[model samples]
Target: MASIGYFLSCEQFGPKELIDQAKRAEAAGFEKLWISDHFHPWNDEQGQSPFVWGVIGALSEATSLPVTTAVTCPTFRIHPAITAQAAATAACQLDGRFVLGVGSGEALNEHVLADPWPSVGVRLEMLEEAIDVIRLLHRGEEVSHHGTYYEVQDARIYTLPAEPVPIYVSGFGPQATRLAGRIGDGYVTTIPDADLIGVFKESGGADKPVQAGTKVCWDRDAERALDIAHRTWGNQGLPGQLAQTLPRPRDFMDAQALVPRESTARAVACGDDVDAQVAQVRAYLDAGVDEVYVSQMGDDVEGFFAAWDEDVLPALR
Candidate 1:
């Protein structure tokens, strides 16, 4: 059976709240955890963006469930070598139960240092080079790389898990999906497109794990749940490329205004309907996703967990 995990939204909750959610997820019988790695929330209304690495440290002590960064950008903001070190440390802390999920990244977080945001092609090229550098350093031998996009000189990770960390590459389109298949240890994406999963497998990702995530709003009041989903995560309804191209939360907020309430209604499963929640997750599983991580968008986390424990998880399993 495919695994069902909880997604801890760093973009929506602070560090302490995330750790608490981790523990709650484990207690509620969620098999694993996926956490967002973001420098900023998509918008101020979503409200929080804690540094992911520090929160991962606390999660290591708080929950035994495996953890994966839904995706991290090693191409910009932070060098691949530094990312390798951080991933290694996290793997050790989790006792080899961690996966480093990487992506080409968005301008939202990458633009913070005032660096130019390259085009999609250039970003993917840089991401490929970054992964190469990270893998070399993870070998525990001094690596001096002078690639077109990055230069790592005599860098070696001193602390590492018994095994090298598994790197899962995130891809949303055909080009990036093929690249993920060619180089990634596994694949990560949010959409449940069976065609893309086929593309990944044919491009050499066969036998590797494929992970995806989605969000839901679980509340007793169905209408109120939809309202919260629209307000807090309406960014999900933004059209193509806007999410990757927009550089600031305000820009996203501005674009978010165009997202109709109906779009969010179609995108997210809301309310206390057990059948609705089960079917939403089953959509990903039917699309060949090996693991599906679900995030609750409402504030009533305890209610969400109780519903999952009593009705949703049992039905899915």
Candidate 2:
């Protein structure tokens, strides 16, 4: 059976709100939590971004739900060695109920350090090496390595959970999917693409969990919900590598303007129809996903949670 979880949008909410949401989600029958890690919101209209690790720290005190970074980029904005320490601490705090979801990262967060953004090929190579560095540190041994993109000198994570933290890799395409299979303890994606999961399982990821997530807006007013969805997440419909390559939130806002509201509507399930919400989540479960997470795109998070708990989740269960 597939597990269902709540996706906390750090890009759209502050730390307190996310912690509160996690507590509510656990109370509402959500089995796990996926919190996004970002330095900035997608656009100013969405308007909030908090340091994800801090929020996770607060979440550890507030709730017992298993948590994972929907994805963190240890390749650029932060060094892999440091991420290893943070993940180790988080695992200890959560009593090993933590997974580090990592990816190649986006230019919007990575370019802040003024490092020239490398091509996707280089980014992927860096991600592979970064994962290696993190795993080494997790073993609680001092590690020193000089790699093509990163260098670490005698780094070790002193605090760790009894078990090594499970690392899940996120991908949007075939190459990344293959990399996730070869290196990841699990796999994550926003889209419910069965073919991608098939490739991951076939490419040395057999028996590993396949995780997927999506967003929706639930309101009595369908048009209002649609508007909120479009405003907050229109970029979800942007095609190609635009989501990754764009260097600023404004670039995303500008590009998202061209994305038709109709497209966003189709991509995000809107309004308070419990069946619709259930169907959106069902798509991911049917796609062979072992875990499914859902995020609400607007301010009516309480309403969304209530609907899911009282109506949607029962059907899914």
Candidate 3:
């Protein structure tokens, strides 16, 4: 069966808001859950960036829906060695209901650690090594390693899930996609593009889950909603290589300021109409994703889900 999920941006709302939203999402019939892990909000104006690992703990107790990070970088800020410990503990806390979604990482945040950002190929190498380290630790083995990018001395996880923790790899291009196929238990992505799936399969992945997510805003006034989205988060729509390596969230604003509002709006759907929202989600399903997650972009919760319940969910069903 094709499953539907809800994604929450960890940095966008506070703990109370997260708990409330998790309850509301479960009530709305979302079967899966994806939460973002970020140390910083794109801009300080976007508000609270809570400790996501802590939020995941509360979420595990709050909802029956399974939780996974959309994608967490186990490179900088936190090493894979510690990530193994955290994920292992989280899995136990969730009672075997957690997936460890990891990736090569972005320079915008990781570079803040005073480490020089390497080239894409180097990042991929680090990611591959990180995966090896994380899995070994998850297997409850005493891991000691001295690799090109990481060096960990004899470590073993005291708390691990009864079952193995599945690792999901996020990829955007062919190289990363191929790496995901070669090593990941599953694939994680935002774009609903099947070419990515094929890349994974050819590289070695088969029959594993592929999850995708998109954004929508539920508002009574469509124009006003679009304006708010474009102002605060429009920078996300920027294209090409240099955009992903930004040093700060404000860099997004400055670069996105060069692009037109319509371009960003193309990625974010806002409506007072439910049919329109359903169609946006359908595009993801058509792209051959096994699961889809919808993030209602703004803070207007009551208004968004009411439309989803009345209109979108039925059409999808």
lDDT of all predictions: 0.94, 0.91, 0.82
lDDT for model 1 comes to 0.94
TM-score quality measure for candidate 1: 0.99
RMSD of each: 0.6, 0.7, 1.3
Candidate 1 lowest-lDDT run of ten: 149-158
lDDT of 3 by residue, 148-240 (tens): 989999888888899988999999999999999989999998887878888887787888888887778778988887886777667667778
| Candidate 2 local lDDT, residue 137 | 87
lDDT by residue for model 1 (257-315), tens: 99999999988889999999999999999999999999999999999999999999999
User: Order of all candidates by TM-score, from best down to worst?
Assistant: 1, 2, 3
Instruction: Tell me which of candidates 1 and 2 scores higher on lDDT.
Output: 1
Model 1: pairs clashing at backbone N, Cα or C within 3 Å:
none
lDDT of 2 by residue, 202-271 (tens): 9889989988879989998999999999998988888999989899999999999999999987878899
Give the count of colliding residue pairs in each prediction. 0, 0, 0
